[model samples]
Target: MTQTPTPATPVHWKVVIDTADPHAQADFWAAALRYVVEDNSALIGNLLGAGAVPAELVVESHGRRAWRDLVAVRHPDDPYDEASGTGRGRRLLFQRVPEPKTVKNRLHLDLHPGEGRREEELARLEDLGARVLRRVEEPSGGWIVMTDPEGNEFCLH
Candidate 1:
């Protein structure tokens, strides 16, 4: 039999969040997921210098330059490009839009608080501005369905 080689592709994935305030969503999600907000200063600077982006469209966030219309959070341990300031691992990108969410999310994240700290973790999340939507139980287990300040759904399991 002949052997075949698998194609090599970078492990890349992003969660898109619809929000009226992308910066606020970035802050809330960064705290909730223990992730770091992407620092896009280098990229933004390059873009501005090259006439790709307008100066009015940039803002300072956490003492770093960021896009005014969108923001992202990335896994803290993931490798990132210091030059471009982009995460190479798990990331959540929040974008601003005028429309409100009208249906249940087709996809959501499950946060594993583990063992018996679910209530404490839930409280912590609430402190960070995540609202409890409901509690769901199943024969196997149960989880708390919650929404970020912007109303994006996530499950604490």
Candidate 2:
């Protein structure tokens, strides 16, 4: 008798982006994706109290203490670590980088608003500090390329 192989489980992850301002990037992305910014204040407080991290390494964002170099946004319906406010599902993490973006991205995100709301969604995103880079139309479909406030590219379809 032959036995079928078991399927492997998928790994959990969050996309990490390098940026000049983590908090600002987090804010923009949170609003754009309808995600919530991860609130790690409780854990930050504990770490501060224990002297595990210095106060100089933290900053206030959205009225909460956040890492000066890192912030994240997560899907609203996903579960997270209560102690650290870390998302266990779909998420994006932004970390501070010394240099600005110098070239086109090797990877980017594509968003689909629905069957007939692309224009509305594009406008909404633009109001949130996204700049339209170009519009592309092809035999298969059409899309608009945009860059975030910090110049990270994403597409609206």
Candidate 3:
């Protein structure tokens, strides 16, 4: 007799992007996606008080303490770990790096702002420091490619 297979469980994950300024990227992405920047000030304070984290590794961001080399943005309605300020749902983590982006991205996000609203969304994104790379029109459909302030590519459909 053949045995039935068990259904696979979904894994929790976050996309990590390298950048010169993690904080700035986090801010930009948060605004662009209507997400919220995770506030880990309480966790940082606790770690500092316990001597688990060095003071030099923390910096003041938006009047609160954050990791000097990394930051994240998450959907506003997602659940998060209160103690760590980590999102349990959709999230994007930006890590600081010394090098700049010099080539095209292997992975990118495609945004759908609803039908008949692509132009409006594109304008809003442009106002947020994104630049139009090109526009693609095919018989099947079309989309507008854009680059964020840091040169990361994304699509508007």
Cα RMSDs, all models: 1.7, 1.9, 1.6
TM-score of each: 0.92, 0.94, 0.94
Clash number by candidate, in order: 0, 0, 0
Q: List the residue pairs that clash in candidate 3.
A: none
Greater-lDDT candidate between 1 and 2: 2
- lDDT ranking, best first: 2, 3, 1
Residue-level lDDT tens digits of model 3 in 59-92: 9999999999999999999999999999999999
lDDT of 1 at 88: 83
Give the whole-model CA lDDT for all candidates, comma-separated.
0.91, 0.96, 0.95
Which pairs clash (backbone N, Cα, C closer than 3 Å) in model 1? none
Candidate 1 similarity to native, TM-score: 0.92
lDDT of 1 at 75: 92
Q: Flag the better candidate by lDDT, 2 or 3.
A: 2
lDDT for residue 45 in candidate 2, whole number 0-100: 99
Candidate 2 matches the true fold with a TM-score of 0.94
